[model samples]
Target chain A: MRYSGFQVIKEALTGHKGWKPVWRDPEPQSHYDIIIIGGGGHGLATAYYLAKEFGEKKIAVLEKGWIGGGNVGRNTTIIRSNYLLDGNEPFYEMSLKLWEGLEQDFNYNAMVSQRGILNLIHSDAQRDAFTRRGNAMMLNGADAEMLSTEQILDRYPFLNVNDARFPIKGGLAQHRGGTVRHDAVAWGYARGADMRGVDIIQNCEVTGFRLENGKCLGVETSRGFIGANKVGCAVAGSSSRLMSKADMQLPMESHVLQAFVSEGLKPVIPGVITFGAGHFYCSQSDKGGLVFGGDLDGYNSYAQRGNMPVVEDVCESGMALMPMLGRARLLRMWGGIMDMSMDGSPIIDKTHIDGLYFNGGWCYGGFKATPASGFCFAHLLSRDAPHPNATEFRFDRFSRGLMIDEKGMGNQPNLH
Target chain B: MIINHPLLGPRDAAEFTYLGDASLINRPDWQSETAAQDFYEYGYLRSNPAGIHRELWFHEAGDRSWLVVTRNTVTHEISNVEMARDVARTQGRSK
Candidate 1:
């Protein structure tokens, strides 16, 4: 059922019992026109767009577990498109735009907050770099502004602007970039796809791909062999493991990236603020918890838990940027397996095996890229061609020396 | 996490810096005919298995030596450790 203000008031008047499950729990079908693997944000969004926008039928999204169980629910929930490169800016800007209209388009409350994001500048080089990045964002039709130290201080008075080691000189602000209710995004997309006659199958693990003669026919799952005319794998964290079953080695590794939430407190952080001199970014949740995260654990792993070194490093950076945060008690911490691509960017393209498509290698930035990744991936699966905004996310970019190294960190996956 | 360094005994994992798969030591020959393909595979492709992985770790905050640590990716359990120099020598790299 479509939720609305009228429905809410009527349900409230009628003792609040008119709500239903967001999406149906359907069993896997034998065959489908298109099957999307991994029912995370990307997969569910792919199904939603495939049906709603592309007008495709007989679509299915297969999930190994419950929805919003992976990185979709494990991220710090920040979204921004303040990128510097041509290969990335337009695509992420498209994603930010989609996020703007997502809640209304999907008929769900995703809590899309455009409460601005500030990337703090500590050094002259970083300022120059972020200045170029701001120009690039504006050039790509996204909103950007350079905030002086006084302006930043006016907003975040608690920020340690005059720290001895890393002084905050200025900041690059994206007024359109902010956090969203990440789990509701999954639920909204799932409900939207379900409403559009797309099947979302849960608790079905794809054991292997049904490949023959250099073409994929279907997948061998725990339930049974489910045939599909086209299969798009959007499993970012386990991309390597899943693709290996098809005998295709991806140019990426999996690393554990951790996120943390502190005990609920007064709303201290107005929006998302990232420490430029270090690897820490934070946003205050609506419930008053301080959400933050930092660099990866810097090792290849399929595990969803990280070691303590990175956690200590993250807290140190947070303390460096905002010393007042030292008094806040951390409520909990969690990790997500990031499909860290070699060039530190995502790939959305067709694989060598016919009828088989791959969409992964998102590194730790998959949350922000969710909408565009799914839309472009659906476009590719339906049209068999990369979207104009995503033309650079190809499998052969690395071999062809067309790497979209956004952070300019070379082939180091962990650094990215 | 603790890495039992071959030369320095048990050491905290914080003392080390990670590079990546130990296979990187076997760099492809630049002068080979199929160098392009070989280098592409060598530089990008990864096993990234969920089980035990032999990875290179440099003891940046310790003895300043590289070690090949055979660790389980799923459980974060370290099984074996050896000097990367010895492993490279055994893989037939000569100066």
Candidate 2:
């Protein structure tokens, strides 16, 4: 059912009974042309692009639990293309563009708000680095503006302008960078894929890959054995665990990252703001709650909960940046497992096994890279070639010492 | 989270630095035939299990001793704590 303002008004007048389910809850089929593992944002988007754009048939997206129960729903929802490296800027810029027209394309109200994102500059060294980063962003055709301290103060009056240790010097603002309604992204893509005859099978966990010689035949799932000509694994934090069944250990670790939200209040934060001295990044959600998060718990764990040390550190950083947050009552917090890659970048490439592709190692930034990750993974799965934008995200890059080390952190998954 | 140090009874987790899986201590020979592949696998791949995980933690703020802690990843429950030097020696490693 196509939705529009007219349909909304009509449904409102008719007691809202004409609305339909966003996506079908389908049973797993015995065979499919392509099978996608993990029904998160990337997996659903891959299936959506495969069916709607690539015109692929007999596609199935297998989920262990419900869709959007993974990192897609457990994020701060900020999206931006303000990156320094050439290996990352273009891909993320493409994702930002996709987010721009996503609602209209998927026919879902995803609430893509390009309110802007500001990365505050503290020290002179940080200003220099942010200047280089802004230039790099502009070189990649992404919007970037270096804002003065006065301009930043004019925008965010609640910030600490002259703290004893770290003073806000300037900022790098991307006018197109902002947050999206994260859950709507999953629903929209799932609906789009399902409308295109793609089967979205929930409660179907892939136990092992059906490997024959060098090629993958299908997958062994909780439901049963399902045959597929090609299998794409887009599982995020569980990449290593899942690939271990195939005797392939991934170059990533599962680390839990926590996020928090404050009780609903009047809208004060106009855009996403990130601290320069610390890891605190925050934005006001549409529901008026202040959503924020900080660094990882700094350990390897699959547990979707974090300890108090990191939580205390995050709140400390928040207080350092904005003292007004000290009074806001904390509503709740949650954690999501991140596939922290060795170089702090993602890996979207085919594995040593033929007909078996892998898409993961997104770390904590997977939420922002959802669209491009899916589109590029779909391009790779369909054509058996890396997308031009994702040419550097190969699994063999680590062995060849050709890593896209965005943060210059070497081989430390948790740090990434 | 608190790590029960072998020397010190219990230490706050904030005082220690994490170095990930204990398998990292098994450093392969540099002059081996498949040194490149071995180093690649050694430096990159990991058995990031969801259950009991044996990992290394350095007491940076205390005795500066490297310790191996066997803990459950799911429940964050610590079961065993031993000096990494002893664990490495038992696994046939010496300076």
Candidate 3:
């Protein structure tokens, strides 16, 4: 049913008996035309677009665990398009546009709140950098505004403006960027894809690939061997592990990134605030809890939990940004395994193996790039060519020396 | 996570910078015939094991020494630590 105020009121009056499960829990079929591994936000959205836009048939999404059990449900849930690089700016801007119309398109309440995102400046050099970044964003058809220190203070008065080490200078605000209810995004995409006759099989893990002479035919799964004509893998942090089954190595490292939420308080933060000097970014949830995160735990591990030092480091950065944050008690903390690439960007390209496509290395940007990643991935899978916006995210970019090093931090996955 | 430094005593792993696979220190000769392929393998191909692993960590906050830390990836337990310079010397490298 198409959800609306009328539907809510009608359901409330009629005991809500007509409400249905968001998506059907179906068993995996023997064969599929297109099989997508990892039923996270990107996978589900990819299946949704493949059927909706590309008119592909017999699509199946196989999730090792429950839908949204991965990073889709375990992220800080911020979204933005304030990118500077030519290869990245257009792609992220496309994602922001998709996020803007996502709820209406999918007929779900994702709560895509465009409350805006502010990146604080702590020095003259940062202001200059953000100035260039804002102009680049605007040139890419995305909204950006350079806010003065007084304007930033006016918007977020709780922030500490007078600090000896890292003084507050100014900010770059993207008024179109904001947060969404992370879980609902998964549910919405799953429902949309299922409605189009795509099967979403949960509790189904891919064990290996079914290959013949360097061409992938299907996958061997926990349930059994599920046959497919083509397979697309979007298993984020598990990219290397899964691809290794095919004896392929990726230029990505897996690291754990932790996020924290504070105890609920009165609404104070108007929107998202990112400290420029450090690696902390925060946004106050609708429930009045401040949700934030920082750098990844610097190691290669598949573990979802992180160590204490990174936690302390994150809290220290948050405290540095806003000393008032000290009063807010941390309620909960969790970690997501990030597929950090060599150049600190993502990779979405066909691998050396035929009929096998890969989409990963998203690192911290995976959550925000859900819609566009799925859309462009679907474009690539359907057309067997790079999308107009994602030409730089190729497998050979490293060898070709066309790395999309956004942070200019060369080759270090942890620093990115 | 704490790494018991060979010289500086027990230190928090946070202060140390992590790099994957201490085997990276063994740089293949660039003048060799298979240098291109060797460098490709050296630069990109590295094993990511789930159990015990020997990796590199720089004591950036301490004495600026590179360390070879042998730790379990699954349990986060450190079993051994040695100065990477010493380890490099054993591997027949200088300067």
Error of 2 at A270 (Å): 1.0
**If ranked by lDDT, best first, what sequence of candidates would result?**
1, 2, 3
Model 1 DockQ, alpha carbons vs. true complex: 0.91
Off by over 4 Å in 1: none
DockQ: the better of candidates 1 and 2: 1
lDDT of 2 by residue, A1-416 (tens): 99898998999999999887878888888999999999999999999999877889999999999999999999999999998898889999999999998999999999999999999999999999999999999999999999998999999999998999999999999999999999999999999999999999999999998899999999999999999999999999999889998899899999999999999989999999999898999999999999999999998888899999998999999999999999898899999999999999999999999999999999999988999999999999999998899999999999999998877889998776
Backbone clashes, each candidate: 0, 0, 0
* Interface DockQ of candidate 2: 0.90
List TM-scores of chain B, every candidate: 0.97, 0.96, 0.96
For candidate 3, what is the TM-score? 0.97
Every candidate's DockQ is 0.91, 0.90, 0.53
Root-mean-square deviation (CA) per prediction = 0.8, 0.8, 1.5
Which 10 successive residues of model 2 chain B have the least lDDT summed?
Answer: B86-95
Candidate 1, residue B32: the lDDT equals 100
By lDDT, the best candidate is 1
- On residues A130-220, what C-alpha lDDT tens digit does candidate 1 reach at each position? 9999999999999999999999999999999999989999999999999999999999999999999899999999999999999899999
- For model 2 chain A, give the 10-residue run with minimal summed lDDT: A20-29
